[model samples]
Target: MSLFKRAAVSEFASNASVVFSTLIIIWLSIVLVRLLGEAANGTIGADVVLGLTGLTTIAALPTVLAAAVFIGVLTTVSRSYRESEMVVWFTSGLSLLSWIRPALRIAVPAAIVVGLLTIFASPWSHRQIQEYRARFELRSAISQVTTGEFLELEHGARVILVEANENDPEKLGQVFVRIKDDPWHSVVVSDHAKTEVAPNGDRFLVLEEGMRYDLTPGGLVTRLWDFDEFAVRLDSKDAEQTLRQSREHALLNHKGRPTGLLLTDGKSHSDGQLMWRLAIPIATINLALLAIPMGAVNPRAGRSFDMLVAGLIALLYFNLINLSHSWINNQTLPFGVGVWLVHLVFLSLTVFLFWHRVRVRAPKNPSD
Candidate 1:
């Protein structure tokens, strides 16, 4: 490789590393905070926060790496222009268009990695995340209860307290349950309690030798009853339904579905998802090449102006990709047309910028 190519590729790699590292840190921070909030609210368990954070990061890497490559190319090229390196290259018979070769050297490999990540790794990560949540959902509420602590269920609508039975490890002693049913409040005290699973998969809390009291809100009415065995049904049906919905939603969710499955699926939403996955690699290459021409600026001009324009262009390119996905999903745009339209537009712009920059650098005729 030539010195120029070597230096440019090395510098692009370094800049991308820095940017990728920074972006990953920011992404992890955001995911952690959100997961922690969910844990606190009992939406998810604290134990799975780190696992979900890791999986979430994996799922987001393709977009993050695309942004990194775009910024890295822009920074490397703009710095070259800013520091007068472009003048040296120009004097040596290297036109602005020559940057494309080195830019692609970095971009092509990065795009391949992004492609693999988006197509395979991302979906796997999303699947893992979904499984984590599904397993948590499938856990019975009674399984989370401790012997000595008061466990509240249904947002404190029902409160239960129990003691451990030394004779029977699986049984609970001195069980107390308080239920608030709006107009009526009931309390139950039992000598011992245990869980029973019916043949149909429903769970019940079986309280032995219990006394129950029902009280009215105004204290005008009271009822008492004694029982040898009291059974409280727990809704296994609701849990089963939740588990079913989660699986269905996962199939419906494009991000969680594998690329192979997506290809086989005939749904328009799946096609939109497939387009998005395919577009990431293409966008990575386009944005990297586009940065070359966008980064050409007058050395004497304000540095921020060129950077601002480049940022806006990158933003627009990504937004258009998202818009294309939306259009395909909504059936407003055909998949074939939507997939390449935005990319072709930016590619043409890239070609135009290269031509315009080369023309501006061309020497004038002595007669004109």
Candidate 2:
């Protein structure tokens, strides 16, 4: 490596680290705030919130890294130009295109990391997140029931209230249940009931010495029954393992499947995902190169101008990528054109900018 290339690479990397860290910290703070509400609502546990945030951050790292590289190169080159250091390099016959070498040195590694995250780590994290949500949903339905408070379950299909004996979790002294089913309304009052899980793993509230009154909805018909003991299932499904298929496979799982499998699946959704994973890394490189010329700044002007422009470009690039994913999924655009076209357009833009920068004459300082 040339001395100039090594110095440029080091400078870009140093700037990138600072920018990347700041962005991640800011992003994490915003995410934590959004998740805190869910934690309070019991939708997610406090411990799980942090884990989920970390996983989400991992999933988001590719775009973050891409933005970092773009801003890094832009800041480095813009600073050099603002301070008139670029004039010295240009006079020394280093063309504007030379920035690609140093930018790539930093970008190639970032791109590889992005690839690993998009292809493998991100998908795995997504699967973990789905599993966490499924477990929480299943448990929340039962856990919301509290003694001494009337609780509505299954969107008010049933209502139950229990008054338990002092210092006993299982011994309830009074139980009331209101059940509303089509064409029937029933109320039950029990002297005492014990909460138990049956041998077959069914959850039941077994009532002793209970009287049940039934009324036909909107009718004069009524019935009453006295029972020594009766049991009602607490959960709609028996208290046994209920297997649920995951929805994460619709997006992330396809990345882990063999490329051939995706091709054979004959699903547009799978094709869209496969294209997305492959495109992210390529986008990283294109954005990196594009950042070099975009980062160039006038020595007299402040660094903020180039930074703003770089941000806009990054925004547009990512939006286009996301739009492409949707287009492919909807079959509005062919996968071949939808996925790679965005990268190609940006890559061409980068090349044109580099060429224009090379042709444009640099202003001279007479003192030099």
Candidate 3:
């Protein structure tokens, strides 16, 4: 309840909010522009681009919070040293290690938010993104009909392949199809094709100048027929929904799993991902504490060397965490030994630096 402690905590919280907000704005702008480009190229639907970008930003909050904590602590401490306030505190018995109390107050809440995002919100966001992509692919397959790709229709019972377009957008350059519905299997190849619509709103791909191969299920009979024209109707909306659900079910992976589920399952990749998620908040706290000792500065210097050093430490810390994830997933490192090693290493380093800062200070002359 000391004035110094209250003032320091408030200052750090304020600085972190300002810095975190600014970094979020910048990161979102860059991510949004890239995501919008994906939308334009048909990688994702235009309608969901902004929503996806928002989810993407939410998933990235840990990185932003970490950076904000680093800068907040560094800025707070370096400014103290530069203005000679640290000298006053050092003389009055406030050691450099004492900075941890206030720094932690900000770090704890930030860590909790990071954990929530990483554990729950992130998975939900990724799941939504995947569903949006699946829905777009389904709608685009029937509505837009891009060339040079195979479009699966009717729960894998029928497949339609389109080759590169030849000039007229309304006309398909070349079409190939294979259909297997219970007792019969057939192959159809066409010189060119185009889409036609009936009065009832049913859409069909009309093939021109084609050959058909028809076979019985028992291989007892086979026939080849030359046809001047043929028609394959696109699936109805209900059929499309079935296909979409099938695709969604197939794509359920670790990225879409909640943290609680991942914790219980403990598969190699899932465990690794969960550890990394937990590490973000832990890493933020570690880096903030580390920055206290790292951020001692000479005000006369042209640039803030302490700030740069803190940044380098953070960069190295994150890279090591990434490396540890790979090692754990590959079975080179034990799961129990993965992320904690990084934390312990940096924690020791922070403690050492803080101890050195305290020990290296000169004794105050009692006469003064």
Candidate 4:
């Protein structure tokens, strides 16, 4: 509420916004590059790529926000020292702890946003990603076959090539197929081939006037047969219709399941997921606290030192959280302990740093 506090908050917010935007753009750029490659390979569609990237960005927002807040506070405080702003404030009886009030003012709202993203938005995004992948995989088998190119299907069980026939997309004037099943290796070549859909909608590639050759994997003898009609299974409509279960059974659901459901779920994995969702928001707050002291830099030493330290601390904090999550899932660490211990450690560190900064003597003023 005071003029100094207002000015400090405004300064911190501005710096945080710039840092956050820069980091997000950089992160998104890397993700987009990878996603584009996958799309081109037919692993995913353009729409699905966009959806996945957008959701991943939402999932990553908390960490980005925490980093931004840390850098923002660090820049603001470090600059204050460099420009003698802190000297004026110190002369007026303000202490380092005075920074917390303004930092918290910015951080509290950020923490709320992180909570919503982790608990609500992230889960929904994950579900959408899973659904998109499921649909893509089911349709991928048939969509992969291209004219004038040899196609490997069913883990290389069959290889087929269609040559020529511009008038018909599903018809080929010349067709060759090799089916390798270890003991019995069969090769089929046909003068003409066409695709047909049964009433049940299953697809089959029908070959006309084709000759088949079969040879055992390690046999000197080979068998040959002449056939007028040969049918090869083209696509499994049934497989496409059967929905696969999603990999995302985490406590957070797109529809926003109550935290209690996650806590009480019988599955240990769910408990681990639940804890992760809850921990993200708490981590945001702790990171904010940690930032206050981590950002305290001596202007003479340069602005980069505090930023480097902040980056290291952030990296360590997130790594510890990941390790704790694994431990909880494995039952090596109790859910109660693993979930909160990492947070408590960082929180204690923050408190100690805050105390140290406040108690330490300010740099002695130079004789004017």
lDDT of each: 0.89, 0.79, 0.81, 0.79
Order of candidates by lDDT, top first?
1, 3, 2, 4
Question: Which should have the higher TM-score, number 2 or number 3?
Answer: 2
Higher-scoring candidate on lDDT, 1 or 4: 1
Model 2 lDDT tens row, 1-368: 88889889999889889989999999999889988878876667666788889988887888888888888888888888888888889899887888888888889999999988887787777767776666555453335455577777668887888886676665787889888876888888897888666666556778899999989977999999999988766764432244245443423466445455666787887778778888888988898899888877777777776678778888998898888888888899898898789998998999898888778687999999
lDDT comparing candidate 1 with the true structure: 0.89
Show where candidate 3 strays beyond 4 Å.
Answer: 140-252, 361-368
Candidate 4: which stretches are off by over 4 Å?
A: 146-149, 163-174, 180-186, 190-199, 206-231, 239-241, 247-261, 360-368
Query: How would you encode candidate 1's per-residue C-alpha lDDT over 122-204 as one tens digit per residue?
Result: 98888788878987866656666666788887788888888888888888888999989878999999989998888877777
Which candidate tops lDDT?
1
Clashing pairs in 4: none
Candidate 4 lDDT by residue in tens digits, 222-256? 99999999988866656534443444332244233
Task: Say which prediction, candidate 3 or candidate 4, comes out ahead on lDDT.
Answer: 3
Lowest-sum lDDT 10-residue window in model 1:
232-241
* Residue lDDT tens for model 3, 87-141: 8887888888788998998888888888888788777877777776776655535
Task: Report lDDT (Cα) of residue 158, candidate 2.
Answer: 79
List candidate 2 segments past 4 Å from native. Answer: 45-47, 145-151, 161-176, 181-183, 189-196, 205-213, 219-231, 236-241, 247-261, 360-368
